[model samples]
Target: AKTSGGFAPFSHTVTSVTHHKGSSTVRALSMISSQSTSAEISWGIPTGSEGRKLRYIISYKCVNQLACSPGCQDAVEGRLTQENTRMTLSPLLPFTQYLVTVTPEDGLPSEIYVGTSEAVPTEIPSLSFRSPDRTNTSLTVYWEPTIVCSS
Candidate 1:
């Protein structure tokens, strides 16, 4: 009924509204962080709506209890179009756990759906140096893999 942001302000009345069934699907989830901070988030739009207007919201929390609750200090809310929607959350602390929720707006009230994702670990690989002779002319280096295995 009420619209915000750069869009025009208006309200519409409907006879009846139906809440979407099942859970919201997260098409893509990622973390955007700097040298010492991280932000965990996901992006996707409600499916099976068949062109119905929708609204999406995402919430998150850090793994380290001392760090902060609601890892993402800011809240992102926006209108959904017919095409797939993508939502990028605010910056968060490094190596944290985040919970996100998405909801669609119908004529009545919006329904809530939730999901969770963890931030990728940030650990630098250790390097080793080797040389055939005392001279530094030709040296060989070995390092561990930068990626982590899930199993």
Candidate 2:
């Protein structure tokens, strides 16, 4: 305290502090089950950014297709929380390669490549007798279905 003659002047100084959190990122993504027309996937929760809730959006695209129409580019969205990080993507093309993306609300997205299982043929051709065309060493049989890899 300073006094001028008989009076004193008082003053105070205040300091401000701020805290910044670290950036977050996706940890891992694994395939739970992948079928001909549907797929289930799960991922690990990210770290470093605490107390901040994030939403996860899942999307996929076919590797062979030119467009994202059939691969759920914008259709499948997963709002997964910290504990729940699993989702199922369906109505996909069979026997096709897909690039799956898991985008978090805080940081950059993580990607994984997955392939669907082959579909079974719906049509079955009847067996025909061709004994006259069989050779001494081998026999020839023919059964045809046009949709080999329709997707």
Candidate 3:
């Protein structure tokens, strides 16, 4: 049916419809250890998935059931644009074992990386020093928060 600024009616029968969206084959996985209660993860874009729009889904949980107590289910899930392949999960239980997985939109279920969060002090302690040991001391330190941080 065709319409030219007027009402038109059309009807048809369909057998089936299929979409052939491809999947990303993860080439590599890199993880940044969690300092206190988080971890950073990034992976190489799949060779075939490049230049194509996609989405990323990350699922994680505490590996040891005992750590989670009665439920032992500390699962966490998130979704992000394909461009934002890397992400950080924070506020996780400190000193806990976890299993993490990254899957593309419609990708298969799989677990590729496993890591533990760093142990943290009950409180953020201030940097303290005592009596410079009666000797002159000097130190230079550099701190970078994330990959996107400038300077």
Candidate 4:
């Protein structure tokens, strides 16, 4: 406090504080299982990075014509401990391409990892054809469905 010769002149000085955001760091994503109509995804957080009540959001889209359809979004909530972080997307189209990304709460919008899902086909039948006469101009075709066919 400061006082003048007459009475007193008082003044106060106040200090203000502000906070800024920190740098962005995200965990890596892993593909657990990929099926004809479904994909299982997983990821992990850094050591000592877990905070209170953390949540995850998984975003995905058809990246290739094989499974290309439209973009889809899903989310997982809870804290992760000894168990591996996992999630599965099912009922997808056969032989399609998909892109998936995982994002955590309090994480930067751009600090996320993107991964691709495997292309699996439901068709498992194989066809075989042979002609009776190799030298004959006329030919007949026959097909037998085999159980071991992959695309």
Candidate 5:
């Protein structure tokens, strides 16, 4: 029998239903360019996920963790919400390797390895003059290497 509201009896009708959404994931990550202290990257989202603002959880860590001071080597993370595929990470150490991961909301994360370029030397060189070899017209001088010797 139908009730006044045209509904079945409470005991005979469905009370509630839960619908599960499909799972999507970040598909790809690529490096666009790099500088001495920054990196620009791009990523791909799952098909059919375009045009909608998506929140990305971005995290990065230096591959050479030993280079940083203790308690300062933790991974850096940030959140961004946009429909575009490009973003920039800055204030990174020069000539270092980093592992970057981007996880879109409700999706699996994509990871990539990136490297920053070497920066110009910032240390001042130490110069010493040899008095024994110095003359009015000629002089001998020695200078200590300023930048770290990578060779």
Candidate 6:
């Protein structure tokens, strides 16, 4: 139907719709270890929008069943830029599983994207000492691998 202003009226009927909207993608993710403190995470920014605003949110938890949560603990928002898209999460427990998300301000749906990193093991590798003889010396070491899963 045509409107009084000579424009086609908006309709809910089934019709062919073509949209040329752009999307955002995560480029890189990494975690930095600190001394007796929380680990730091640095996330790469998504590229596509020329000058649109962007917001970021991060969530994390321990690997233990009692400590891990379904949703994120902290929510952070900020404007999108070419240089400042990366952020750091601090004060987090050592050796814990963390889930990070990045959302951008675009007209397209599914703004939130999530990524996860395995928890760093808190315990150090066990080692044993052995001596062959008084004149000859020998050493032995043992270690374990960190376990991580992807969904």
Which is the leading candidate under TM-score? 5
Which of candidates 3 and 6 is the stronger one according to lDDT? 3
Error of model 4, residue 97, in angstroms: 1.3
Q: Candidate 5 residues 1-151, lDDT tens each? A: 5888797755766689774343376776899999877899997776667766677777787775333444225444445565567888887777667888887777777889998787765557787553347788987677765544211
lDDT of 2 by residue, 1-151 (tens): 6576765676787899875543455787888999887788888767865565667777787675312345433332233333357887777766667788887765678888877787764545655554335788987786543423343
Candidate 1 similarity to native, TM-score: 0.34
lDDT of each candidate versus the true structure = 0.42, 0.66, 0.58, 0.49, 0.70, 0.43
Q: For model 4, how does the per-residue alpha-carbon lDDT over 26-116 read when each residue is reduced to its tens digit?
A: 4566667776666677666643456634456556664444333232322222222223357776555445556565555545422222333
Across 1-151, the per-residue lDDT of candidate 6 in tens digits comes to 6778787858887979785464565456555443223444455555565565555544443332222353233332233233455455555443334444444434222223222334544545443344324434654444554332211
Q: Per-residue lDDT of 1-151 in model 1, one digit per residue for the tens?
A: 3446566756586689775664445444443332233333344444565556555444444333223354334332333333234444445444333444444344222323332334445557776554334455775567766643110
Model 4: per-residue Cα lDDT at residue 105: 56
Alpha-carbon lDDT of model 4: 0.49
Better of 4 and 5 by lDDT: 5
Q: Which 10-residue window in model 6 sums to the lowest lDDT?
A: 107-116
Q: For residues 21-130, what per-residue lDDT tens digits would candidate 3 score against the true structure?
A: 65855556668556446778777666677686667667777665323354235444444444577778765665555677777776653455445444524443344443
**Considering summed lDDT, which 10 consecutive residues are worst modelled in model 1?**
107-116
Candidate 2 vs candidate 4: the TM-score winner is: 2
Structural similarity to truth (TM-score) of each candidate: 0.34, 0.56, 0.55, 0.46, 0.65, 0.37
Global CA lDDT computed for model 1: 0.42
Model 6, which residues run further than 4 Å from truth? 1-22, 33-35, 65-83, 105-151
> Which of the predicted structures, 2 or 3, would earn the higher lDDT when compared with the native?
2
Clash number for every model? 2, 0, 0, 4, 0, 1
Worst 10 residues of 2 by lDDT: 74-83
- Candidate 2 lDDT for residue 62: 69
